[model samples]
Target chain A: MSGNPVERLGRGTTDLVVDLGGLARFAGRVVVAGSGRPWRLRRLLDEVFGIGVLSISIIGLSGLVVGLVLGLQGYNTLVRFGAENSLGAVVGLTLIRELGPVLTALLVAGRAGSAIAAEIGSMVVTEQLDGLRMMSVDPEDFVVAPKAMAMVISMPLLSALFITLGLFGGMVVAVGIVGGDAGIYLTSLESSVEFREDVLGSLVKALVFGVLVALIATWRGYTAEPNAAGVSAATTSTVVASSVSVLIFDFFITALWRV
Target chain B: MNVSPLRDLLVGCFVLAGLLSLAYLSVTLGGLSYRGPGGLQIHATFDEVGGLKPRAPVVIGGVKVGQIKSIQLDGDLRPRAVLDVDPAVGIPVDSSASILTSGVLGDQYIGIELGAEEDVLKGGDEIQYTQSAVILERLIGKVVQNLGADSE
Candidate 1:
């Protein structure tokens, strides 16, 4: 606290590097523990129920709303150039390739990501994790692995649902509301999107985001200080860090996909 | 976290919905269909394909019957396109396959002009009359040249 500016900057850099290394190690541990015998199907299912099933309403509603807005906006813009027929392609491609996975990840990071961090952080503060350790139950296997594994399993499914609902919403606006030909809308949408590129790429992106968000949330909670303030800080950090990493990783994934 | 039958049921439903949505996205919207060996496969060689791409629709009278299976080069080094046409559409052997743009700036597709021949095209048959894509710049240049000739 009393160090000069240069010393403080140096110390901060060291802490950042150390924290990154720690996070990576924690992620490896979770993967190893998750992949081990017995599979812990029950614990994983409970977490999936908490994380994936519970977040569906928010994800589905947001997807539909986003699609509606895209349809409205795309129609207005494309109509100027007499390209309103391509509105379906525009909305579909945008949602499938970019918005669907990214938005779902961000929403999940906010909803389930924060929940995971808070729950695990509070457990840390309350010495529940320690109690599990005392009982010779590796906390990583009993708790962390299931949560992390559930996030991975849930992400792509939730993303697919988001894209589907978004497409329906777009159709409702483009065909039902905007007076566009339903056949033309659907044809354009189907023709424009490719299976290998758009759909697979989207699932891959969602999967990557799932891994990142899960690792960040769990790692933050596991490494939090054993106090109430630490739990709060861990929860906040999980949200902020998960969101920023999702966006950054999204850019890289997109660039790599093109390659 | 304790596992309950109710919770398992809800999770099952969620997983099912998610998978159904994924299927819809992949099969319906993404156009991942079964490429059975059922269609009438025909070949057409073009001088220049322009912006024509694989999987572009093969249409007759503005109705899509099938699509372009693949675009490759022939022995003559020209762009040869394999078209997967519907078997029921008894297109004459003398029909021509022309690469046409959908709109002013839309995707390029193959348009078939049916001939008055009695014999229908079969699998692996070559389309004798094939028209290459209309390059916009070439069209503009021709117009500009025609105007110059008129002035002279």
Candidate 2:
């Protein structure tokens, strides 16, 4: 009442609203950041660290299993109708459209998204965020920006890894058990799938999910009012938000666009 | 000072090599042949193509080399499926083309059975052998009956 509309110091009703405000401000800020900053540094880290290094094993194993099962299941079913060759069409479409993005998002959200929430949440409880604010820095620009940048930049690449690995995985199934040629599987995947629109459509969806993920985790974490419980809440919110947002976006995009 | 940076570098390189090689192996293995690439062009006539789409995989011996190029009816109204075969595969003219399901409740694709004929089929040639899709529910019912009988 005496000084400002709402106290900014510790945690208050105003701070909770500020947390919401910070999230609201992110849309415009991110666009500006995207256009002006271009995120090259973040992209490099995301590629090397977030996607290329950290994600390979999980994506590889997941893709392998998915490929094997698809091949076996597809072959068995086709044997009855004697339409086994059409296996390419089934595997290709499913890998590109459905399993690719959904599986990757879920896996990565479990892996990376949660980690991000916990790390940032830890910072908030430790007062590193408040320290930055005291030094005349916007914690949003300092803490939230870099990691959010990393997530947004890397998601499409991660999604690509998920999808391509899935294809490879499906092929293993195709070759080892289903008894299909490997070269033929790649060809079917390449030709049946239109690259620019269809594959790109999935990648674009991943990018959107990435951005949503970064925002949700950063918003939830960066504003937690310096407490152990707050950190936990932030962590839970990050996972739920990222997973829900990925699914909802997937459905809407699948319905609305040809991609 | 205890351990040289060169030693650390060696370890890093070793790790990197292992990961990259695995990734490469998966790529090469997964790069194996995909079906529906070559001469299986479609010259079929269907009352309704249903969900049948062009460039769909046409499989033979569980390999897909060509696709459904088009579907249209003939003068006598027979469902004519024109196939394109890889010149290398040497599909005999007597081979039969059947529309088969890929999975239990999956999409339909053309299946080819090699015919024991000397002469081979040409680009525009149609295979006389054909089998259509089985109604899924009926097939499941058959399975249930088979299972029940086996139990008895």
Candidate with best TM-score = 1
Best by DockQ: 1
Relative to the true structure, candidate 2 reaches a TM of 0.59
Across A43-86, the per-residue lDDT of candidate 2 in tens digits comes to 33432364335766787688667866786787789779876666
Evaluated against the true structure, the overall lDDT of model 1 is 0.91
Q: Please provide, for model 1 over A85-164, each residue's C-alpha lDDT reduced to its tens digit, 9 standing for 90 to 100.
A: 89989999999899999999999999999899989998999999999999998899999999999999999999999998
Measured with C-alpha atoms, the lDDT of residue B48 in candidate 1 is 100
For model 1, the stretches where C-alpha displacement exceeds 4 angstroms are B34-42, B60-65, B72-77, B84-96, B101-106, B112-128, B136-152
Tell me the lDDT of model 2 at A50: 45
User: Candidate 2, residues B90-139: lDDT per residue as tens digits?
Assistant: 77777776677655545577777889999977656656656665666777
Residue B129 in model 1: shift from native, Å?
A: 3.7
* Deviation from native of the Cα of residue A216 in model 1, angstroms: 0.6
- CA shift of B84, model 1, Å: 5.0
Q: All predictions: root-mean-square deviation over Cα?
A: 3.0, 10.2
* Poorest stretch of ten by lDDT in candidate 2 chain A: A43-52
